[model samples]
Target chain A: MIVSNMSKDELMKDIMAHDFKLYDLQLYLNTHPSDENALCMYQNLVNDTDELKDEYEEKYGPLTACSAAGDCEWKWIKNPWPWDKGGN
Target chain B: MWEYEKKLQYPINIKKPDPQMAKFIISQYGGPDGELAASLRYLSQKFSMPTEITKATLNDIGTEELAHLEMVGTLVSQLTKGVSPEEIKAAGLGDYYTDHGISVYPQSAAGNPFTAAYIQVKGDPRTDLYEDMAAEQKARSTYEYLIDLADDPDVIDVLKYLRQREVVHFQRFGEALRTVEEKLADKKFYMNNMINQPNKDCGCNKPKTKDCGCNKQ
Candidate 1:
């Protein structure tokens, strides 16, 4: 999970950037079939992104207005807002 | 994975509804070439995409389109608020409400509902990406027309937002095309006119004929 706090806009911008990068990587891999470097890079990005997401949730209120206490009847309502990095 | 705050995603403050414009705009909500189709079309095709980059692009673009769809739904909902059966009938919305019951649906404003034909799932990346490019252009033109037809500021604002996304999607699709081309071997890229050749359906082994069995153009 991300430990540092990033501004909402800054974090969203990062999310968009990463989204584009990941999408590009995914498309490239489809035709190229295999590229270990791309895979590794993709993996690293994914891992780092999870940390960023955690940081975002902790700093802001739940991305969604719902509770995230994990013992809820409907967990989906706990989903973070789209602007939240988690949406990315 | 991306991190963002929810409050910022929809920053534009939309005022109360204008019923007149709402009627026409709802067509886009359910229209053949409207936001619902765009969202479902792109989102459905993402799974069949061959590359990670393409899939990711599809996901992002598809997701964005979904947001656009929601915006259209929101507009429709707001427009219909406090509407009585008589007012709805007066606005020619009774039929719409009868079927959809004030619920947002994926049908065309003409009353034609959502069809799988809206999306193409060709296994061939080239064909699918090109279709995506065309779809963006079609949506862009529709927005332009909608803007031309409507004069309300709120409607215009929303239309403008949707229009900008079309341009962005077009750019992304172009990039996606180049990305696909760059992956091709030099010999395969130039020697064979593979792009023109009939693209086989990636979803199923059956060779794709003239049409990709998607929605009519």
Candidate 2:
């Protein structure tokens, strides 16, 4: 789902979607811990999140954290910052 | 769906290099405590972060460090390009040359490898975030020192940009830490101690030794 074929914009959209959904579920579950519909929705969102995460990682380096596989020369330690793109 | 902020994501243009300043400037690339370490330090800690705010801040700051790392790299790369092997050796880049043979890596301007000791993965939000905050200040101070040594206008411009970023990051982390504190406020254990205790069962008791269970006062 997160393959390089997807544009950076699309991948970013998917990431934001998952983040918001994760937060929504967290907030809902905090009060309605037994809502089966919410739980199921949360599970589905989580699975989507994972798949997208994998895709994004394979294509545009990593967005969240490090990879232990050693593909990156500095694998465990590195990233492109918000302003890492250089200049203003 | 999340709307992306395009303004926050763009490439930086480090101006052209000056050979005379290149040698000394490259030192920040791999000196004992340099930008490379700072980037690696924050980026590495995100793996074990406990809170979303902490994770997000780490992600943002870590990303910024990578940019700074590039600025350092770009500075070194541009500086060393035109100089011949003889020139490099004479310029004291001989040590730098022996390690990478002119390849600009993030290891060090001196060519020493990166180490994990530069950062801590304490696994507690409070401790890790506080370390991150301190790290930003230290990095900003380092940038200030670099600015003091630098004579090139382009180099100074880049350094100033980086220094301002450190301040921004410090502020964001402060906000994140407050969020964490707010979450912990309801818990009696958190209310009693300013820092979170490492031993969850230790009940926020202040430790007697240097390795206190809590990270902050």
Candidate 3:
């Protein structure tokens, strides 16, 4: 039920936020593996990142090389790479 | 076995190019104590970890280091982007440019290519975890040096974030080492050999399996 009309930058920003949350939770879980609350939160964030990534890639391009699928002509090379102005 | 995340762990928006800064920062991308080595080290070490907690710790931290590697590469690439040939030569990136153009290559600022020799996968949970902790500190110091050299707020901001992660990683590795030590004590085991044989079929090698009943001599 997600809309696909978001600009590339907006989509990228959303993905970045979710990814950062997952990274933070991952490190926390590394030390506090027994925390049920953190485990639950981590699961939710992982789901969010999955959805955001799917939506972004479908509309714009693959975020990672492996995500490039279905008749795409080497799309990984086509980018404002993460270091590029639009890539970040 | 890793999935690629599209976005950076941090958002890096460098508005200016500074090749001089890029020269030193490239070290973090591929230097001896760089993120690349950190990532490779932990990922490689995870396979032989004696406990589930330590294994997961190494895997997760190793993965995070990959993200950090991307961030550092981003910083170096952005900083080196669009500079004049004269600027490149003046910034002392001329040698790098001769080899890599503006693209990011896995090499230290001193022009040493990244080598697996930079990391140790000793296969002992305690030893590897201790090494991981030390690696994080070395990376943190490198970041501190980069932060001092950087003049741009945006670049410094990202560098600070990366440096802070090293501190957090160090703490986590310390905790993992403690967990391994406690497990060793509970089993009345001492790691006497430098060569770790975590996969010995003998039940003594397994930490979680209680009552394997192989008494250490």
Question: Which candidate should be chosen as best, given lDDT against the real structure?
Answer: 3
lDDT tens readout by residue for model 2, B1-217: 1232222222334455454456555545665456676667667777886676667666656665664665677666655655688887776677767766766655543445656666677778888778878877877887787788778776787678668777877777787788788888866642644356555665446446867656576
Q: What is the per-residue lDDT of model 1 for residues B1-217, given as tens digits with 9 covering 90 to 100?
A: 4333343323333455455566677667767678777777777778787767788777777766665676777666666666677777777778876776666666665677777677677878888889889988988888888898777676688788778778877877787778778787445533534435557434444455768667466
True contacts kept of 1: 0.17
Off by over 4 Å in 3: A2-7, A64-77, B187-217
Worst 10 residues of 2 chain B by lDDT: B1-10
Segments of candidate 1 deviating more than 4 angstroms: A1-61, A65-67, A70-88, B1-8, B188-217
Ranking by TM-score: 3, 1, 2
Order candidates by DockQ, high to low: 3, 1, 2
For all candidates in order, the CA lDDT equals 0.67, 0.63, 0.85
Q: Clash pairs of candidate 2?
A: A81-B63, A81-B64, A85-B10, A85-B11, A85-B12, A86-B11, A86-B12, A87-B12, B30-B108, B30-B109
lDDT-based ranking = 3, 1, 2
- TM-score for candidate 2, residues paired by index: 0.54
Residue B152 in candidate 3, Cα distance off native in Å: 0.5
After TM-score superposition, the amount by which residue B6's alpha carbon in candidate 2 deviates from its true location, in angstroms, is 14
Q: Rate residue A82 of model 3 by lDDT.
A: 70
